[model samples]
Target: MPDYKHFPLADTAEGLTEAEIIDWKVKPGDEVTVNQIVVEVETAKAAVELPIPWAGVVTELLVEPGQTVEVGTPILTVDVDPQGAAAVNGSGSAASAVSAETTETAEAAEADADEMKPLVGYGSKTTVAKRRARKSQATPAAPAPEPVQAVTVVAPRPASEQAAPAGYVPLAKPPVRKLAKELGIDLRTVAGSAEGGVITREDVRRAADGTAETASAAPQPVTAEYDPATRERRVPIRGVRKATANAMVGSAFTAPHVTEFLTIDVTPMMELRQKLKGAPQFSGVKLTPLVIAAKAVCLAARRTPDVNAVWDESSGEIVYKDYVHLGIAAATPRGLVVPKVRDADRKSLAELAGDIGELTAVARDGKTPPEAMLNGTFTITNVGVFGVDTGTPIINPGESAILALGAIRDMPWVVDGELAVRKVMQLSLSFDHRVIDGQQGSQFLADVGELLADPAVAITY
Candidate 1:
């Protein structure tokens, strides 16, 4: 007889509540090996591929693609017995007996499976169902008043004037008609380019432009159609975007945030970055300002440990970290994700660059594992890449501080009593005021700025 088992959604390190079934790798009756990736699920953090723990033949797919299932929900069922097929094919009477026994066993097994513990952790707590009181039937509402119809009167026109000329109606696709309508262009007045005198998008655009030019010469009152489709769009927030939103809200309201800004001349850091790019040790590694800033953060955190600590409200204590798990905030197609570089304080500059590169690549590919994002001691968000000057960034949940790197631009600076052009950058530091005081936060920000201003300062620190 075949031994049946169910596979439930496991709790990943991110503590995901639900995930959408992005894909199913196996169908019913397909043989799957132990530890084989059987399905891909899109959780709030990333797309995770789940593997089966035991080899078996897939009996049924409990969930379909595009369905969002709660954690601990059964996703699939499988049969572990491979020799049951041979036994059934051997003898007719024996086969019938085994079939009846298997039916009973399967029914009992399914019932037991319902109470089975989930593969990852404890199952959801059982809730007692309470009977709701029946609501009294409502009385029928009074009939609504009839709406008044408006009538219009117009003088009759001659048939020649009322009717349009034959083939005068503009030939155009539905989209073209809609476009013309939106542009307030009368199709009858515009010329068509197609063989059948059908209007194309280009023709409509040209006509609209001409109309704009004509109107520019002499302004006229124009009436435009309101298109709700173009006015607004609604996207369901469920995955990474949803998680980020929740975390940000929680962090903002729960933590007393204090942000400080500093503008620094980072010419030396930029020069060092370019030099590293050409070095053999830094070959194949992306040497960006963020890498230097991240290293600076680690060094600065060592001097001011409060910036790397977390506030424990339940225990009424501050948890200061001795080591650093530096998180680099990367904006992916899905959403913003911060994957940590483990033991960042211990890694060399080149090692940090490589780790940042790998983490960013995995995040961009939407393949970052949930575990890689947890337990971050500090976070750095490079808003500079987007050309942003500076932003008051929110601290990531459980972390005391977050640093935002701004765009590097050429600006005039007074150097040695003379004005000259130099690379300038802005830094914004946001920290939990409860764990990090204004003095400590300011010191940390100044240290980072100093390191960026003069890379040699990092060696002394």
Candidate 2:
């Protein structure tokens, strides 16, 4: 008899209540080692691969792909006892092996009927099984209609004497049925456009609009022909997109935002970046204007620490930190993600450039770990890459302020009492009004602008 162990979905991060199973790496009867990647699950934040903590042979998959399960729910079961498994296999009798396995399962269930075992990192709790009421098991079908007689009476039959169509059942899904009910449309009278005479939501809508043809008409061939009216595609909101939406909503409403803008000549910073590209220390590092802005923000935060602090409403206190965990906002195919560069204040220009390069690459590949996105003190969004001017940016939740960098363009400016063309850029800073006053916000933005105006000032400090 083999000892079966249940693997539950672990709590991967703070405030994560559930995760959707995206894929399974191992199936039943496959041998697995300890710490082996078993399944990939998608939380609201990102897609993470869960490792099996113990070595075993996969016995069963309790959950299916695309199903969203709550934390601490058993996702799979494994047989950990190798000797018992080998004995069952050596028996050579399939029936006997199955019987033995069944007996062992029953015995184990009886022994631990009142107790639940917790998987690593996840708490244990007894879950009540609630099977969904399937449509097949819900209402019985109506009787089939009888065939017409060769000879019929001249007199018409009464309403109660009429028979329904043969094997006729509305094939709409639950949602489609509900929609039809709400639209006051009879599903029985609507024609099904789906294969096998299945009713679809579109069919119901078309029927309601008096545009649906009868099912008895010749069925249309299912082909690749596209129609503009029905050519729309829908993508599910999950993973990074879902997380970004919730956080943005919370941040927008919770924080009292005040945005300030400043336009400055950044010709010196651009020149400095070009010069650094040839330096031996920055030979392979890719330096961009965003990197310079990030360093300037760190330097400015030293003078105004309130901009790097969090306003904790629950604790009724403002949490300030001396170290800066700078977040760089990166847009990926999945959605927008902000992965932080840890201890950014302590890194040099070359080091910061390297870190930014690697972080952005990882984020674009959709491989940013959840931990990399947490605990950001301040965020920088380079919307200038999209060839747009500066616009007010929303602050990330738990962070005090966010800085937006606009596209740098050659514009007219005054230099030594003479009009000249200079590389000018705009900066927008949105801060939490509760923690940072207007004067402090203005001074912080000014400091950042001054650094960009004269890159040599960074060395003086």
By TM-score, the best candidate is 1
Against the reference, the lDDT scores of all candidates come to 0.75, 0.75
Q: Which 10 successive residues of model 1 have the least lDDT summed?
A: 146-155
Across 294-359, the per-residue lDDT of candidate 1 in tens digits comes to 899989988899998999999999998889999999999889999999999999999999999999
lDDT of 2 by residue, 89-134 (tens): 3325434443344434422431232233333423234462322222
| Residue 345 CA displacement from its true place in model 2, Å | 1.0
Candidate 2 ranges with C-alpha deviation above 4 Å? 82-231
Model 1's number of clashes is 0
In model 1, where do residues sit more than 4 Å from their true spots? 85-231
